[model samples]
Target chain A: MSTEVAIVGIGMHEFGRTDGVSGMDQGVVAVRRACADAGVNWEDIQFAFGGSMAAGAADTMVSLLGLTGLQFINVANGCATGGSALFSAYNTIRSGVFDLGIAIGFDKHERGAFRVNTKGGGLGDWYGASGLALTTQFFGMKINRYMHEYGITQSTLAKVSEKAFRNGSMNPMAWRRKPISEEEVINSPMLSYPLTQYMFCSPGEGGVALILARADKAHLYTDKPIYLRAAVVRSRRFGSFEVLAPSIALEHNAGPTVDASKAAFEMAGMGPKDMDLAQLQDTESGAEVMHMAENGFCEHGEQEFMIQAGDTEIGGKFPVNTDGGCLANGEPVGASGLRQVYENVLQLRGQAGARQVPNDPKTAYTHVYGAPGISGVTILSR
Target chain B: MSQVPVTEGVFTWPSDSPQLIGSRCVACGNHMFPVQQGCPKCTAAETEEVLLGRRGTLWTWTVQGFPPKAPPYAGNVDPKTFEAFGVGYVELPGQLKVESRLTEADPEKLRIGMEMELVIVPLSKDSDGNEIVTFAFAPVA
Candidate 1:
């Protein structure tokens, strides 16, 4: 209900691990590409939001982009950092505070294992240490629980991975482009019970940057500007004990993805049924299925059936992760969220090429979540 | 002697030794751990401090079969050494469900709704004999 902020330009560095480019270097490349795509000069940008999880504060990402004159804000919200940054940029522009802004999400996550800063003043000691470790393990444990509760076979989870790899094969940007069979996914190294290596996203390096401007100025930047209809951010709170019933509250809280998605749908004046394309934060294959149900894309425990029915394919009811998701595209932390947004921008712009959803899509949604249950949902339209 | 520099932090036993202080919003009566600069729910900056309980019921858990990819967590253990460590979601007395690591490595033994307590232990030891302590949880009788 605020001022309309449209994505004037989008740019992405080739998605892969690059030894030569640090996070900042890759960020600069994407930023330059976005600026060029938007037909705007670096000096015209009034504000900048840099999103990265692995980089330390003052890590040249903000300054190196030649955005020194702009009001720069650095954000690190775990995996959802990029989407969070985009939300901040949209709000800033919508507030009439800035006319042009850039949200840059770039990360060379291959540098280290994924770690969340659960330091003092964040959560209780018991909740910080054990809770985080427990949540990371929750995916595997939930898969086990799903197996026990629903009588789902290991192959049920494997089918999700097999489909992701198959979709990745058609995506030039995906890290693992080779089609993987169900037997291969089930037989891969088991990280946790019922979850195999192929079931998880491979850690890699990449960059995704987006440019936003006031609706009035959007056409000056690009003829095909994607409008930001809704951007919602929400965090999970410890629900009641009864809410923790048998299968609901396994992780940090009632899946924030669903809550954020619902809020976004209401804010955008639309529902899951109206979505033409979607790019979800699929850190693991099981998450893809869980989120599909939780986000109202499908009913509970019906995601496996949907995948088997090819309802989630490029030509199906709703094409998901056309550029491949974190599972096949690699979860590059900071870059992953914006990377999803970039895919939406491309699909709406009719530039997705081989991975393009069959029908000309008008509305798309991208969702991303981070540690301790930070969630961001964005609704984009042409 | 190892040359790791120990970071200064208190370690608590029975899991909840070092109490986690959180702020309860005076406006909305919402509770948040590790305290917040402002109430995220109602945007209230004024609040009161409360001590969270130690013991809770296990919600669920996972083991770090693979060593974390981050630094300062290196050389202590290899990912292969621990195939499956138990982690759990523990429900505190105040209806708070905290995520924590279980003392048991076998995932099979971990049961839903099992009782658990908090334990703060050393995450790693620096070369200078300093202990980098962090929080974790273990099962209770």
Candidate 2:
């Protein structure tokens, strides 16, 4: 029988752009907090996984945590590195190879870069060596297509941004805590066609640390342990996008988010209907609605309707990104996945103060996607 | 005009005219543009190279209105320089849709499903004056 893994403790530093501290410093603080919260000494962590995209020096981040005794593996999967690290730690515990593991994800604003790795090449490469690092441009392409196909108006897209900013106001950790007006979002500087500055996720710095332990050891750590019901990661099969009909294949690797969600649901023996809440990698406002439909939260082309009906609000049918997603909370790259997990853990543990779901969410899911078609999905249950 | 090196120095072009080099999978009969390292359909690395059709139909196109923020993009012009550049997907005879920049700047002149031909243009010159050429598509006569 396979052993089960549970999140015994979680800790997060403030989320925002930082220039005062190093990424390693942010990671060490969160790691220390998680260890203290779990009542486990730092020396007890058998393995450490550090997730960072631009931190170039990952090993130094691990050593800064004073976890020199543990084996360390650094992960840099575009934006999904944090979730990848969490999965690695979960699998390590499940395999009985380690009774305890720590996953640290952190990135400082100063270290942020547009391009991830130039090794394998990417979408920009195909466009004659264009180095467009702001992923908003790609999302802008999708938005343009969406507008062309569904007649979606810029006003509608701005509404999504307004709702996100309003939600962010309740999240003290969010970077842009001040609510934005629809006019502001609409008139914001256009980054790309159909996408404005307000529609893009802000770059920020922060770190999220999670402690995973064997089910038996979980009870010793915290009474509010959230079991890792399911964890799955998948990459896009090369050229899968080219084979589909042009009308259907809107973009490359857009299908993985849905596929990963389905796999996570099957593994957890649940469906979108069973999820009391959801936290998605909302890098942009349009992405929140797009991914919701793709993940089966709503029918295709019905996301706009759902949003207009307030079904995604705090007291609606299903609350999404209640802690404010990357759009409002800021995209720290390596720390995003763990940030979602952190929100899921808090909601499941009845710890989310202002943004708490009413019915006491027993189950929740977090989906994250990285560049070049990397994706991760995790289901959490109390 | 300066001397430009053609496929003559590398592999022989199937036709005297410009044609794109591509590969076709024997397993799934899938067509790949710019030729893939392996067959994405069946993962069969064994494939045959074939010349793609010179003429195609435009699927959709967009003009980059701003300069890209990253490297390898040699166009040092300001963001406004891209205010009229065009990029789009064109469907070839084999139902293959390939993405390429358009030769024309007027968006109104470009139409979906319009017949087009592949044209390789000089992207930039290296320090040694070696002209680096890339592919773009223009309306076919």
Candidate 3:
């Protein structure tokens, strides 16, 4: 099928904490930069989809950008919020309703362990009082089980974070940029057993914006247009083990990432082998390891070998997470999903400095999976 | 002066061997914890209240050191004095794998596939002086 949505411009407000910088202002910075990068005026956007977790509504930008009276919808689908916004824009533009639009994501949260209100989130007093409400516990349990079943070791998990920090040092937009040894990551304060402070991404503040236009109108904005080949988002049904869930009856079906990537690969008529690189979600080191398998990049039993053999770095076979990923960049929730897309565009356009994969990659894949098992996957090509 | 459940409708109180309060689809035999009116698996409306297995094997576990983020964790305890605890998924035979608080926190004391049994423990006391009881799993000898 012909996917006709093109990303003409991508901009990001570096993924880090900025005191006194409101999420809205961060969004304004990204949006204006994207509009300028696309060579289009803010007034040119006819519609918009925005993702903000703790931030306010999508209409919050209206006060800054002026009341253009555009259709702005706010998305809050966990970590996939930004990816959903991108697809929402793509689907809307492909239907020929709106010619041009923008997708923006931003978030700001207090430092330390990210608190989740389980009152209305399907978790209750029991989960919270027992400390089971924390997402760290989930990641720890999942990885512990994975390691027990497979032969994966602590060294492999530490190596994933090592690669992330190494790559993050190269990307100015990344959050934790200092390159650390695997020993540091392994010895860091253990949040949950096996997952240390370095393994988990802290909640921070950041923003990202992507300008989209019809394929035919894309060149009117920029010559190095990144076409959206496939965009798919999926939700958890039954038997999917994920964060924030209390119990499971049985795992009778696939997880959200598996379902999402499967649908995306089918829609794009391209499989994992066709892509040159990826930005698999790494909320923790285990997430990247698991998602790489979920997204069809490798088998469940191969991550240990691949990561141990130095095959996941920039020059490796797949070169996944070339832009430091959530592990190194720190998750700003709403902004993280599009941050993956922003890096993918840079990689495709040959604009990713220092961390760019060799031999101008033609196609790229990005995937994000979040709490309670919601997933989003996108494919882009030059 | 009395022990009450932290939340109602989750387990039987004042019993020797209490099973998790759950529901099973009468038609498809799917089980759910804390009770769901409708079966999510087969979408069947015919369901009945049932007790989950008390004995199970450990599937996975972890130790949470810091205090959980507040609000729904509603126990009135000082964050600084909060002690570390173990949380895990237990595979109950003929039932689903359910998340549980472990009786032990030390990693050396825990192991995957170890036999475990449900036990009632105090979570926190309520304002009324009642000990808020919750479910946990202890390694079975």
DockQ of each: 0.19, 0.26, 0.70
Candidate 1 lDDT, A1-382, residue by residue in tens:
5688999988787676778777767778888899889988788888888777664542365566564567888887777788788989999999999889988887776533355443522433333332242234667766555555555566667777777788788877777889899999988876655577788886687777899999988888899999998888877754422111111222244567778898999988999989998888777777777777667787777766677787778888888777768878887778888888898998899988877887799999998876666778999999
lDDT of 2 at A107: 82
Model 1 alpha-carbon drift over 4 Å, by segment = A56-68, A110-112, A120-135, A142-153, A240-255, B1-58, B68-76, B79-83, B90-141
Q: How many residue pairs clash in each candidate?
A: 25, 1, 0
lDDT tens digits by residue: candidate 3, B1-141:
999887778889889888899899999898888687888888888889999989999999999776776654654347678777889999988879889889899999999999999999888877898888889999998
Where does candidate 2 stray beyond 4 Å? A109-113, A122-134, A147-152, A242-254, B3-17, B55-63, B77-84, B103-117, B120-133, B138-141
- TM-score of candidate 1 chain A against the true chain A: 0.90
lDDT of 2 by residue, A216-326 (tens): 878999998899998888777644332112111222454678788889899888898988888887777877777787688987677767777878887889988888788
For model 3, the stretches where C-alpha displacement exceeds 4 angstroms are A1-3, B74-80
How are the candidates ranked when ordered by DockQ, highest leading?
Answer: 3, 2, 1
How do these models rank on TM-score, best leading? 3, 2, 1
Using DockQ as the yardstick, the better of models 1 and 2 is 2
lDDT of 3 by residue, A1-382 (tens): 4449999998899888889999878988999989999998888899999978887886678889978888988887878889889989999998888999999999988887778777757766666776677888999998898888877889999999999999999999898899989999999988898788888888888999999999998889998999999999999878878888788766656689999999999988999999999999898898889888889999997999999998889999889888899987888899999999999999999999899899889999999988878999999999
Relative to the unseen true structure, what is the C-alpha lDDT of residue A42 in candidate 2, on a scale of 0 to 100?
83
Model 2 lDDT on a 0 to 1 scale = 0.72
